[model samples]
Target chain A: MKIRALALALGVAASGAVSAAGEVEVLHWWTSGGEAAALNVLKDDLSSKGVSWADMPVAGGGGESAMTVLRARVTSNNAPTAAQMLGYDILDWGKQGAAADLNAVAAKEGWDAVVPAALQNFAKHDGKWISAPVNVHSTNWVWANKAIFDELGLSAPINFDELVATLEAIKKAGYTPLAHGGQAWQEATIFDSVVLATGGVGFYRKALVDLDADALGSDTMKTVFDRMAILRSYVDDNFSGRDWNLASAMVIEKKAGMQIMGDWAKGEFLNAGQKPGDDFMCFRFPGTSGAVTFNSDQFMMFKVGSDRRDAQNQLASSIMAPSFQSAFNVVKGSVPARTDVSDADFDACGKKGMRDLASANANNTLLGSLAHGHAAPASVKNAMYDVITAHFNGEYSSADAVSELVAAVDAAK
Target chain B: MSQKWWQQQLPKLVLSPSFALVLFFVYGFILYTGYLSFTDSRMFPSNELVGFANYEKLFALRHWKIAITNLGIFGGLYIGICLVLGLMLAIFLDQKIRGEGVLRPIYLYPMALSFIVTGTAWKWFLDPGIGVEQIVQSWGYTDFEFRWIKDRTMAIYCIVIAGVWQTSGFVMAMFLAGLRGIDGEIMKAARVDGASSVQLYRRIIIPMLRPIFLSAFVVLAHMAIKSYDLVIALTNGGPGRATELPATFMYSYTFTRNQMGVGATSAMVMLMTIAAIIVPYLYSELKGSKKS
Candidate 1:
């Protein structure tokens, strides 16, 4: 027993010596044009810290493929040094004991003070931080052609009634009111905005965030569905199966008036050399002002060999640094997850978002992003996805959607 | 000279690795998945057994209903069209046609490409803005609308059109091989007996191609059941789940939704459906062969 103990100590000492070199493999789903550009910032920053970053970037915007790969690695006891995880994925993985406790890094960096409470909830497992947030993306923004709105003497709407009036005016002016891709996720995105616009933050919180069935079946939800039905009418006939970038292009070409999508749509605008608030305008979806429903792209460091352990910690620290957050989120077209990041390089739209995030945070109304990531468990979210997609496709009635929503939530449990 | 038991078992030992591979890869994984279906596993497989709950959720989903409906439509049209068109193409090519070798390769080349790549090419061809619709409309048909992909009811047929285009070449190759193996003297005898071309093919050639037909049917049916990548690349089970198939649903449920139990259940449904189709087909083929 004494010899075995001595051998274990020797193994630890040898690993401790090897860890100083700092090499880590990181798995992520960030291979898109803009996403790749954003990920470079993190990789570059890590390199400057003398940490080797082994990038295993899986292609897919939703990280569906990457998650599958991650699961295989985790199941095989070969999880990467770090992995890109989001929202409930953090909790889900943490619950499965697949993630290492990031409390050491969190304590060293004092992350608990600055990170948003909702984000903390997602990144924590039983009071220990498990993931490091990179950027906060609000999914309720309405992107519009500023030139078209200006030419038509239109202003951004602040409420549902005014938004409807704007849609009608845009339609009357011989433009497609809503530039939309008829994919299920795209429909779910629009439905999320409608939920925010018609039902307000409280209803969204009660129905989606809090999972209250009564609020899901409320009159406000019915109005939201009615608004979705109206919004459906604004889409062009051939909008079905169109890619999101193509929909964004309609607005870019001045062929359409607006697109209700996440802040990531800014990447498309930027890619087209269009300046925010000049070529296009980004505003909160009507009636959801001062309310931000958000999801953060975060990296969770997994437990690996000692050599990778040092590299993972270094990468985590680098990712949270102010410069890296600013540079990464700037390219990512999202606001910095850290509230203290400088906004001097940000455009007018980004500045507005930063300001909105601050206000929403102060007002205790910063809700989790429902449409994009895990605002609920997988079962409930999928059921909600099906019901919303069906409703948008004109398969389910407004009342039926409410009933289905309730049943879906009940069934999820 | 007597050999030890260990020395005598060496040849069997050499073959054990292959047997173990087949047992594990083919059988073990399938059985493991079937075991997972009985649990309430989410994100990862859990040990807690919750019988039939996942299947219940799958059945309750409207998307699954649409997916099953689409599977039926796509499978029926795709297999039916491929069989008929492939037989016709093979028969035409077999009539001592000019450049038959070149034509055979041209017809069979599509099957060589990956389905995802083929689906992308098909998507472009079927796209309303840049494809056949645009070309036809450019030809001055102002009101022409070839937007079958945009219509929920007809979208499955559009997929079927692409599927048939992809698989017909494979079926044709199979039929061509079958035709080549046919005895030339039988055709000569039929011709001498004053049998018409149509009657000779209908009466003798088709009946002689029964084994090939069964092989093609099994191949196409398996392909149809496992159809996911093409649908994902082309439509992504989109237009609000209108074009979803069971395979895509299973994939989405497994990875995107992270409901492994439900994914396994959906996979089992696909397995059972294929079993239902192929078992009857095999039974009929066996019975017919016995009677003959």
Candidate 2:
């Protein structure tokens, strides 16, 4: 009798497990404090819909490690239900036919109409919705300590010359002019803004995104390198191997005047309990106000079992919801990916980011950031990183840098 | 079956599963990587072989050239310094000093820490702002500067320093054991013959530790070739690829840069380099044991 009872109980447990709400395994690199908090909002949203979340978090700043993990997972046919991917990596994965077709949920939720064309370019692969973009992070922003600017009597610089003058003034006053990390990505991030500022949107598109030989090796490219060299002089000697957040902390503590970083740097400032307009100021990198170099974080759905399709769709739809978009990006320090989302909940910097993104989009200046893996494929981007970083470190002259850039891009291609 | 046959067969049976696993996982993956090096695999492995195209590209890359050069400097300095320092420490410890037991563990403690931990701790210690330079400056020598970790030319040496610090202790243990195993009668006879300690070590004791030296070289050479975590935790092959080694280049190319073919090529090169060192050593060791 006891044996029969035990077997009956085991049978009941098995059926209960099978009939429970399906699971959505999400792989992401958003493991930082603010990022984790933002991710929790989505996790809770999914949980409310009777789907359990299997978190596969890989903690690397650039999502490089996460991409490696995702590749291994997909190659082994154990792909996560959803993965937080960025830029060309999404399209690359989609091209492999590993990404699920999310046209059903996307069309239902009208993702085509809401997501920006720039984002949609990556979100859709071969006319099928493959990823749901979460937020748009623009790289051409300068975060400044407002107190230093106020005390130094320096207004926001309007152009490259004025920006250089401001950095000189700040240096003359004995503060490190630029709070910058010496890492390759950080240097490349600065390069993104410098290129946009030096040659405007068209040249940036030609030189970085299109990888045009003439434009890359042109005298204008040499001028960009010269400006980069000038900017390099303003950085502190101890900047080598420093993390990006530590650079942000320099600005927060008034040790440096400004930092050229993505919108994510604002998270560090905000996390330090500083208000946007009062304590710190966010402005477009000089001369890049009308243009934005952007990379988006998107949750890409992977092809999975038929029984879990409903949960996958639910996760996709939830990610694209305007409510989640606004709430998540508010904490994530990036503007919402959706075009129609209101900026009422955003802080001063968030408001500025939304305004700049919209204007850049409307003006056809919404270029993808090469530094953040939006403009080029990983091979080309990394090749570019090598030259840009080398140039920043004074390893090459301006003319040599331009030629090297051309050569590197051609070789990588 | 005979009792002897059962004993031998049982041992083989007990080891076969692990041996098979090692063969399939290690050698099999190595062969697969060698095959992948010939293909145009990017992001994912593609079966389409490109016939030495990846090798040509790998050779053409300035980054790979820099990585190879850095490896030479790091490997040479790391091995040379570690062997010297380790021998000196072992010789000192072998003098029957007070608290030898306590001192021995202290010397070997760094080996117990992972390369990652050693790299990170040394990275902080070598940084200009918060480490040796700052401490020196605070001591009224305001002009003191130790920013090699930031200097591209000097950054590779910083890696060598960290590598040496981590492995020299283990190397010391090897040398100390070798020193201890040297028959005391030989040392006494040398002392009675009016030979100084330096002469005794140079002419006799050092020559007797040839196998230990070879073993140490083999160990350090392989460690230097496979040094990824330490470099990653330290300079991250940065200040503009100055500290890049083949291992880091292999990883960034394969995983980050989407140049899996080039990464595989680099990996195969590393494998060949390690084999060049290990194979002959293994052969001689086995041959020597057989003769004995």
The candidate that wins on DockQ is 2
The 10 consecutive residues of candidate 2 chain A with the worst lDDT sum are A13-22
Off by over 4 Å in 2: A1-21, B1-8
Tens-place lDDT per residue, model 1, A162-259, is 88889899999999999999877788887777887777777888888788978988888888788888888888888878879899999999999999
- Predicted candidate 1: interface RMSD? 1.6
A1-413 in candidate 2: lDDT tens per residue? 99999988888876533445677899999998899999999989977777788889999888888888888888899988999998899889888999899998887778877777877888999999999899999999999999999999999999999999999999998999999999888999999998999899889989898999999999889999999999999999888778999999999999999999999999999889999989999899999888889999989999999988888888988888889999999989999998899999999889888988888777889999999999999999999999999999989999998888999999898
Where model 1 places Cα greater than 4 Å from the true spot, the runs are A1-21, A305-307, B1-11, B277-292
- Report lDDT per candidate: 0.85, 0.92
TM-score of each candidate?
0.92, 0.97
DockQ of 2: 0.83
What is residue B262's positional error in candidate 2, in angstroms? 0.3
